[model samples]
Target: MSDIPQERRVLTAIPGPKSVELQARRTAAVAAGVGSTLPVFTARAGGGIIEDVDGNRLIDFGSGIAVTSVGASAEAVVRRASAQLADFTHTCFMVTPYEGYVEVCERLAELTPGDHAKKSALFNSGAEAVENAVKIARAYTKRTAVVVFDHGYHGRTNLTMALTAKNMPYKQGFGPFAPEVYRVPVAYGYRWPTGPENAGAEASAQAIDEITKQIGAENVAAIIIEPVLGEGGFIEPAKGFLPAIARFAKDNGIVFVADEIQSGFCRTGQWFACEDEGIVPDLITTAKGIAGGLPLSAVTGRAEIMDAAHSGGLGGTYGGNPVACAGALGAIETMRELDLNARARRIEEVMKGRLEEMRAKLPNGAVIGDVRGRGAMIAIELVKPGTKDPDAAATAALAKACHAEGLLVLTCGTYGNVLRFLPPLVIGEDLLNEGLDILERAFATL
Candidate 1:
């Protein structure tokens, strides 16, 4: 049980006075590139409530962008991390190998979807994990090209920016990205050119054809995709799409990499979303929910492929920091103890049911567009009232409305029309409902 109360309470305006002052300070101190969903500065957070500087307790539906699955201040995570911190903070794993790092790698080997002699290497962020995965794939396959899908967002680094599909915010001015990266259409059911029903087969065929034509399959090192698209609107690729791509990769000797950074660790009703399709990737990248809010990421894969790198080829100074590893161990324990996988499923049922009901009853159902995603990683795509055209304006308005009412919601999408919901798995049923109620009211206001 957390010390903070599990409820939403607004004592002042959204930003309040203290948060306004903090925002001013942040504006001067923080870089201009940095951004936040809500202007309210968080004082503390635990369970499903985020207490801001103004004493406003907001229902946290974003979960710090799906980074805190076991809640922000999970007891075990704090306890274990504190224990590790008291002993020693940094002895860089690359310099003096630590037990915590090895233990975390062991956990990754066991938890990631694979049974064939798995191994892992830890990194500091999702981008590092992804870049390392690419490196490993290239080393093993002795190939240069990597294939990514439409609307897929890998990371912000040069290589990952080349892999990502979105252009405005992620890759607007940043240029001269890494080379040998090819993009293909994803099975985005909502806007699939052919149609949603045919998206699975058509998109698969089209992607393969493009790869074969543009970049010879023989020269491709990897085909990486998010089983459930993250910043690309939480779009779960159409059924059979993953299996088809995985099969193609296996047949062509291309490393099939699952970028589970935002969808792994019980966020999508499974440890990894690839498990939903029973598709095992050669390499899987994970982060966000792994370390109970700590910055940690990993590339877990088959031992043979992982060992393709030279003895001293892969490593970083802060990869798998001791405290972060301890937090990850604690987070895994908390997940097992609480059975958060089942909890995530329950959240899905409750959220999907409520969202569906709301969609049916909302004055302009078409404006709500599509409601999709698995488990707690759900999203609703806003569209024009009478057409399938994206309604980014409505999406922004709705998110702002939610924020004003002390509910934290996030908007995403290549077109910026998705409202994503990612509440902590430990969120009380009442708080979940209350948050959804706020979202419904926000929709009504729109």
Candidate 2:
């Protein structure tokens, strides 16, 4: 583990001299479109703390956007990756097969939901895994139309961009997206007009109605959704919503894909978010928390659906890099040893309790319109004082306040009015509490 103390220590201002200088350098070298939430550069991180170049240690609530559930540089992951690096770097899996890749696929098969003889294929990132899943679905169903939800986020690839609903940032200038993609409503409980109790059935009915009237289920290749939406906000679909859509897909011969990229690997208390409602998707796309901090993603699903692709039809040069596979194995070892699934449930108890308390303490018509999500993937949606309209500016200001106070936070949602918390599952309770304190202080400022 990193030697940095498990406490928020600010030796200087949040973006001190060193970080400011790096920000200036980055401005010249990096593209403006490739934005960053914080300007400070990290020197080291571990156990819920990220030490910046200025030596200021801030409490990490983002976990590198859910990429480091086992800590930024976990011991097991580092050890395995180092050994693999020393042995041999790469001889692409396709050109020369390797055992590490096979082992990783085996693990994925065992880990992902379902017991009907599952199979898996590894990739370098979540987007690639999702793209490949789409290919397999289309091939198996012999259909072309793909259905997505209103606030769901898949990835940035051309195909995923079409799957994702956000346009301002992800799909603004990247037009001419892939064809045969359809968008429908999601049961975002808090935002539903007819209250959360009925949101599930209402949204499902509308979605099915739309599909039947327009795309028609017979032509739909797949129905993809995030059990807990990520960049579009930590929006958990209303209860019964996912199951209804899933049943519709199955009945219509449409492949059901759960984008578990952000909510998988114990982030949602369960192994995957879909398991919360006993949803057994035909294909599940995973990444982010899969290989510690390394680049790795997998598409795990039923053997028949996974094997639909022709032998030479799917793969990439660096899809299942040996080093990443080792890291994944090590990550799995750490998860098993630490019982991170239980840890995530504990996280929910602490975080949800604190956030709900905060919401209650605040007066009626406060900026926080809603507090929602599962496990560590929680969020607070900011809204106008008297109405349910999104308060994006207040959300940004609160996040900036948190950043300055040594509590690293992130904002999401289609309207950019959600403050999301994705702390590493291994984060200590004391430190997590302290970060929440700073968050409370930030909200007070708003």
* Cα misplacement distance, residue 344 of candidate 2 (Å): 0.8
lDDT of 2 by residue, 121-153 (tens): 889889999999999999998999999999989
lDDT for each of the candidates?
0.94, 0.91
- Number of the top lDDT candidate: 1
Error of 2 at 43 (Å): 0.7
At residue 140, what lDDT does model 1 achieve? 98
Provide the global lDDT of candidate 1 against the true structure. 0.94
RMSD of each: 0.8, 1.0
Q: At residue 434, what lDDT does model 1 achieve?
A: 97
Clashing pairs in 1: none
Off by over 4 Å in 2: 363-365
Q: Clashing residue pairs in candidate 2, if any?
A: none
Compose the digit string of candidate 1's lDDT tens values, residues 99-208. Answer: 99999999999998868999999999999999999999999999999999999999999999999999989999999899999999889998887789999999999999
